[model samples]
Target: MNIKSLLLGSAAALAVVSGAQAADAIVAAEPEPVEYVRVCDAYGTGYFYIPGTETCLKIEGYIRFQVDVGPDESGPSSWDAFTRGQVQFTAKSDTEYGPLTGVIVLQANADNATFQDTILDSAYLDIAGFRAGLFYSWWDDGLSGETDDIGSPVTLHNSIRYQYESGDFYAGISVDELEDSPFYNGETPNNVGVAVGLGGKAGAFSYQVTAGYDTDNEAGAVRAMGTVAVGPGTFGLAAVWASDPGAYYNAAEWAIAAEYAIQATDKLKITPGAQWYGNYGVVNGATDADFGSDDAWKVGLTVDYQITDNFYAKATVNYLDGDDIDDVTTGYFRLQRAF
Candidate 1:
């Protein structure tokens, strides 16, 4: 009787323990899906985040320098260095009211007294299509194409901009601040501009028109640009005009540019372009007059080779047509990384 009872009790206990172990194994074997961060590379300084998560912050930027050689052949030759190292933080959080977005961008090229030392490039807020704070002017919305540069040979400016888009049509309004001076009085003048753009499979075309008044002068202008893709090659055109030139009286400025590129191989790309600048007036003997000869133009050619997806070498030459016109040749080697 003792042996049978002991054996039965031991078997019952073993069965209970086996059932508990099986339950634990089943729980441990179940797999759960992993969450991943979302990365967007379509826009400037792409963003990163966890999918379906709240606004995640992202930072991206680049550094570049170039060596310049004067075109006078015997003229002074030196290395010109420039850099744009920026960390742009952005967030887009969903709220019961709606979606809100914020951005802060800071950049520099060492320190100099030429202009403001710490140039706050961009800081702004956006809700849907409405935007407010310092931003790019509508007249230069096309500037995005040259993201590598603040605004081409020039740096960026602060302005209040509003943007909206529907289908293939887009438009925006930008109100900017103009420096104060005798012509602009001691008060900063407000300048406003509007932009309209159309994009489709054939490529994209955008035009911007602006008008505003300062203390003692009025300014207005129009600019148009387009891009076309031909097989593996691409071409682009840009035209600009202004009525009240700041340097010349009643001076009108106009420019035209075109570029073509081809992939000679998997690692090499060659782009050649020419630009023309025409002016209407000049400041001669303290008086503003139509000098006609004051008009200027520029032409450039570039060749770039990709050592790897993140590294590249480029060479460029530019010819300027003006009173002190000079040819400029530049070479650059750069490395980049992305996350």
Candidate 2:
């Protein structure tokens, strides 16, 4: 044990193996600061940002296929085919009291076999502009064509609404629950509907007016519409009035409509429509108090095409004539895919 005690135990075993290799090269955690998924553009495009929660979300959907040919509804020039699917989910945030929203939609119909279960095409809640539960009301906001049949076959339900907007003006009101309308055949009771709306837009025009009331057959309805921006597209007009047979328009005791939407390029579109009724009184499925004398008329043509970025295709054709109704010619053909 001479040479200075073996060089002082080999310099203390190389300083204890260099302090265990600098404590095994240090780093035990750092991968946990990731949060990724963010793009919420404040609720405009596809949305996102739900990961740790500033709420924002969006999901969209569509799937459809259709074919139909008519003659007073599949009894004279019959043809049919159908498929459908839909989905939606939206959420937003921005507290204080203005931007907060929620929505849900689900739909399915593949006729007779599978996919017949899901159905709740809307579930709502909106804020600031107030809203609640189910949806679709305002007499279904008609007038874009497919040969106008002004509305009131029960456009969804359960509601409570309110709205207001400035600048371009706006207004709304609702309080529905039409005891399962479709013109309620269980004879009266289970009613209470009311809706009102007013709209606006200027420069290139736009307008809307609506009203409805069906306090258990105390009857009521009204509608109005307008549009302009002539030349390459847009031109419209609409009117409706009712006072009987309850629940919104009841298929006319007064009606009028017209349209012209032509884009024809950048992926096609075309529309041409007309409608006139005046004491029409629809009766397709029983339960009625009718409206007035009887008279009807329609004419239509519609087309749309855009085969990318969300996909689409549509077709329409119509011709109807009436007075206790019967003359017919109808149409449909469609395809869709969206996201």
Candidate 3:
């Protein structure tokens, strides 16, 4: 070959080798992928997080099935027949923002239109001691009175809330609206209220008081509840008082509940509880107050077993008495697996 052609070929080979080396260097300098941690707020109010991170995401929920053996056996009997509750799908996210910590939640239920319709249960943004968004009403725990029998009280309402901590005492205040359904016309505009709660714990005893108001109609209520651990068991009591000037028969009502939990074994727990309420105007009108006054009572027993950190089984039986109303009985058996 000619010298000029050989020189040109040599230069081309060198340029190709340089181009390949440059591509290799670029690949080596690529940014590493970020690793993230997950967080979840499941099984009610507790929040859990994964290790080694500031940002976390968690998913949790459960399913429940109920069997009813009412006063008449021939009246109704079958599987997928009685009343099947919905499955809850809840997610939580936690992160740090400058000097503040932020938490957000999204929860909903599946299959049951009676309770929820893939709703935004809690769409709140919380940071430090303040929160604002859509969430559960502050005064609702006692006013709902649904008892988790057929529905959940996780009503997503608009609200703004604040929490403060001092020493061992913690307090919170919230202003929000909630569903006053099955009473006063379910179509009524959201009822507004202000809720206040205070809680403190020392040793084995913990107590909390939750109260609220809706001044427009002289409608307001309050709740006081506490729990104590005694020996191998725990006991709790709650009382609620509410008044609705808009009602006719009885304008006021109150409810009291007591519960006891005993750990029969390391994996087994038994909880027995009872609740009594009087002057439940709405429910009174719905059921037959035909046999007695507007008084109602319920007795319940729940057994739970934790097979593992991710698996559990729960069975519950509730006997509700509205006096003269068929003595509604609800029993639930549920098995849940967590991820």
Best candidate (score: lDDT): 2
TM-score of 2: 0.34
CA displacement after TM-score superposition, residue 215 of candidate 1 (Å):
7.3
Query: In TM-score terms, which candidate is top?
Result: 3
What is candidate 3's TM-score against the reference?
0.66
Better of 1 and 3 by TM-score: 3
lDDT of 2 by residue, 54-135 (tens): 9998999999998888854445537877788898998989999979899999998775475356789889989999899998
lDDT of 1 by residue, 253-301 (tens): 5666677766678888777776666753344423442234455555666
Error in Å for residue 272 of model 1: 0.8
Find the 10 residues in a row with the least total lDDT in model 1: 146-155
Candidate achieving higher TM-score, 2 or 3:
3
Alpha-carbon lDDT of model 3: 0.58
Clashes of each: 2, 0, 3
Candidate 2, residue 232: the lDDT equals 90
Worst 10 residues of 2 by lDDT: 182-191
lDDT of 1 at 76: 54
